[model samples]
Target: MAERITLLVGGRSTEHDASLHGYRHVLSRLLAEPDRIEVGAVCYVDRAGAFHLFERAPWPEREEVLLGGQTLGPGAALERLRAADSFVFSLLHGNEGEDGGWQGLAEVCGITGNFGPVLASALAMDKHLQAVLAAALLPGLRVPRSLLVRPGSFDAGQVLRRLGPGPLVVKPNRMGASLLTTCLPEPSPSALAAAVREVFPYDDQALVQEFIDGREFSCGVYKEHGKFVDLPVAEIVSSGFFGHAEKHTKGRAKILLSPENAATRKMRAFSQSLFEATEMATFARFDYIVEGDGIWFLEANTLPGLMSGSIFPMMLAETGRSIADLVLSAVSECGSRPARDKVLAYDISH
Candidate 1:
């Protein structure tokens, strides 16, 4: 029997549009290989946190608001999810989608899916925490030095002092796709204050790191037949630091299918180490900054984008694995995992 598959895309995050692209890309790829699995439904979680379902995959651009269909409220969505014999491909990015909230929901509702376990997703989402974990697990790993700025307690002077004298990268600690991320020439108190203030509305905590001017690269890690393996490294040559524009906007950045240079070898090793240390499941992507031979650990994306042009898919293509291949592999591995007891009600009877 063909496995029922639902691609969960769009979310209440800055990366919602990117998720839409990824959904369309993956859905199209899966459709091309029809005998492998059944593409059942596409669910779009809009910016306002509403669940809209489509019997057929909605047009990526036109599918914004919940159209005239069976709009699944929170409870209904959960119930449907728990009851279906389907693989939920969560192509969501940032915050509630990728920052463990969705994974936690699956855990609470006992739904089987890919991405990773709840703890791994939670650990990988926070920049500061992931860096701290890498430092502890992989000693001498050159991670960028940074400090966390919590809400209502962002002291600019204190932040500048910790990060020291250098170009600084200020970003939301838990956000991805480089949303609200900025680079300053120097970690001046005023600049740091302004950046943190801008970042605060999106997240409760922000990360400030010393900017390292180096070659940017990303490598993918995935379980092939139950063993973790590294994908090809893609060197990102961007006009500037790869941020929102470079990521979402086409032609803003160039990707090179790099050879097995010293950087790629080290990155592959780092990717495996980070994946193991984080206890990541199924798949992940680790980003790095290479300054000569010294590789600086940037971050790990638990739910990396699967858009056709995205680095993850590009790396997979270099390895001769299509999007359908990845989806099939995930389904084969995750389909048998025992489901958790579903939550029947929320106790909102007040």
Candidate 2:
């Protein structure tokens, strides 16, 4: 029998809609390669956690939200997922979604290429911890001076005592997307406390680092069989820094050709080290900052946004790769993995 496949899209996060857009991209490529695959369903788990199979009546173009003519609810999502022979999790941005929750569930039921288990997923999500891990593996890499703030017990005053006054960049320790990132001038002791409270809403634990003003850049890396191979480097240009809107909005962030420089070489080296250290699988993207004479590490995205024209895909095209090729490379590598066989949950026990 041909293997049954289920591609899960959407999540309860700020980027739920974006994930849906990415899913359409992945599904089209998968459907086109009919000789090598079978489709069980392409389901959408709405931002509210409501699950529904792709219905033709809802979406005019059936290929966009194409389905197997079977509707599944939230309760049935995982059940049907458990029964599939293969799976694709086309999620983008957000804590509950890409941060690892869905991948964990996929593990329990059996789905291929769902990234690592909960801990790896959990560890990779936070910017602070990612820095901590990167520091261990690539000591030569430049990272900003920063501090980690755990939930409940936070005092900006105490933080200031260690690295005092002015020019601070603070972000959530556990979340991705520049959602609640703050860049502040030197603040009075009283004002520092308020700023700390501001970041509290985003993450219980946070990382406040010394500001590194420079150009933002990212590199996408895919697995060439078993070895890690680097993709084209795309520099992000924005008036300020590349924040949430820049990443999601069309034409906000610019993906450029490689700039020949020592800094980029180091950034690539740093990226490869981080990927190996973290044991990232299949495809991933790393972010960086190029300062006057140094490049600093930024957190990476394991599941980068990939529509036909997204940055990652755009970057790949410069290297003479097509959307069809990109999808095929990723899916073929993922399918050949042992994890793919272990996780494709076509049958779930109640």
Candidate 3:
């Protein structure tokens, strides 16, 4: 008998749609391998933060069938989740889903989800914290010179003075998919202030870093056996800024599989080290920038998109790995441990 899988998609985050797209791709891949996969159920979290349960529905293709359903409140959803003997695949992006919120809940519920533990998820979700940790753990690694801004204390003048001149990248500290990411060619004090204000709606904290003009690349990292495996690196050749628009649009950016070279090798090494330092497990994608100076860490994605044009899937394909490989690996790692026993088992094993 095939193992059952409970795929969770959609969240009350900015990347809710991205999660839905990822679920579509993942669902299609699992359906292709019926002998190994028995998609037992799917739980959809609407933008309004409502949980709806669907029975005998493993496939989600239409809006009516996908969005319209018997509303199962949080208590019922958790009950169904706990009742199933399934590997929970949290394909959520952005805030509550990927930012250690769900991971913490899983821990409290004595369940171990697909992503890493709560600490790892939280660290990776906060870009500023991750950068600080990376710098401390790997002293030789290069992180961009930047300033961290909080909600009440966004001193644009002070930030500019410290970061120096123009072309700074302002981004939300805890969000992904490049949402609310902006590149100001000439970021005056007013421009920086406006950027911070623009990002305030998404996150309470924001990061302002000196924008490096160089090649942007992303590498996928997954843990197997007892070590981390780095996938082929892919460079993003974007016509303009590689923000949310460029990320989702198919033709906006060209993803080229970077050959094994000094730069690519360095990126892979850094990625593996970062994964270890951040305590990331299962799998993740680390993005970087290479300029005349050196390779600089951009940010890490704990739950990267598995959409048709997502970079992680493209990079895995370069190494002859498919979404099936990822799914099977997750299933094998999660095993048949019951949700109520996972935390205790994890404690004993560690």
Question: Global lDDT of each model?
Answer: 0.82, 0.68, 0.82
Model 1 lDDT per residue over 80-132, tens place: 77777688888889888888899889877876677568888888889999998
Tell me the spans in candidate 3 whose CA falls farther than 4 Å from its real position.
Answer: 336-350
Q: State TM-scores per candidate.
A: 0.92, 0.82, 0.92
Worst 10 residues of 3 by lDDT: 337-346
RMSD of each: 4.3, 5.6, 3.9
What local lDDT score does residue 303 receive in model 1, on the 0 to 100 scale?
84
TM-score, model 1 to reference: 0.92
When summed lDDT is taken over every stretch of 10 residues in candidate 2, the lowest stretch is: 55-64
> What is the alpha-carbon lDDT for the whole of candidate 1?
0.82
Task: Give candidate 1 misplaced runs (Cα > 4 Å).
Answer: 56-61, 336-350
- How accurate locally is residue 115 in candidate 1, as Cα lDDT from 0 to 100? 53
Q: Count the backbone clashes (under 3 Å) in each candidate.
A: 1, 14, 0
A best-first ranking of the candidates according to their TM-score comes to 3, 1, 2
lDDT agreement of model 2 with the native: 0.68
lDDT: worst 10-residue window of model 1: 59-68
Predicted model with the maximum TM-score:
3
Candidate 3 lDDT for residue 243:
89
